[model samples]
Target: LGMRPPTPAHPTPQYKGRARDFLYAGAEAGVMVLNAGADVMRFAPSLVVEEADIHEGMQRFAQAVGKVVA
Candidate 1:
């Protein structure tokens, strides 16, 4: 969460490059979808995904973005 602050996918006046990169990283990790536009991230976990799985998924999500932002 502290890795990088979230920003708008479609900034009103201008689009930001870093925000778009963050969205792409999240999607590549299979952790969540950047659906709700570039500014929002959505986690669509199935009911079958256990609590442990959720935790692991989040960890993976963080790792994926960490590489990009770090």
Candidate 2:
């Protein structure tokens, strides 16, 4: 049984509006996230999610980040 480590908590406090950027980008990429602060994006997933769902979500989220930082 092999499993990857959990994603570390990423709290953005110095970059202004970064969380907001992620929020919009994630939405466009089919991922949902919340801006919990000026630069913090809150992430929450369904309790009854499957492994495949998690992978797909991460892929979409990565796409969103690419859009925001590119």
Candidate 3:
């Protein structure tokens, strides 16, 4: 999340391997993200997911991204 936003013209291309880093870190943090491709990290929390759960997921994801960058 600390990384710059993807460019509108080439979003996924900018974070190709970082997506995998996120997936692994998310898994380690007990978050499941479905991968659409080599560069896509997809999040589809359940329709009944609570707000707190969403916030927690984001925290996990941000931590993962930080580790990856660090």
> Using Cα atoms with residue i matched to residue i, what is each candidate's TM-score against the true structure?
0.58, 0.73, 0.72
Better of 1 and 2 by TM-score: 2
Candidate 3's displacement at residue 22, Å, is 1.3
lDDT of 3 by residue, 1-70 (tens): 2333322211255566567777887798887876666677777777666869978987987787667666
lDDT (Cα, tens digit) per residue for candidate 2, span 8-29: 3353445565777788888988
- What TM-score does model 1 achieve against the real structure? 0.58
TM-score ranking from best candidate downward: 2, 3, 1
Model 2, position 33: C-alpha lDDT score: 76
Cα lDDT over the full model 1: 0.60
- Ranking 1 against 3 by lDDT, winner: 3
Clashing pairs in 1: none
- Of 2 and 3, the candidate ranking higher by TM-score: 2
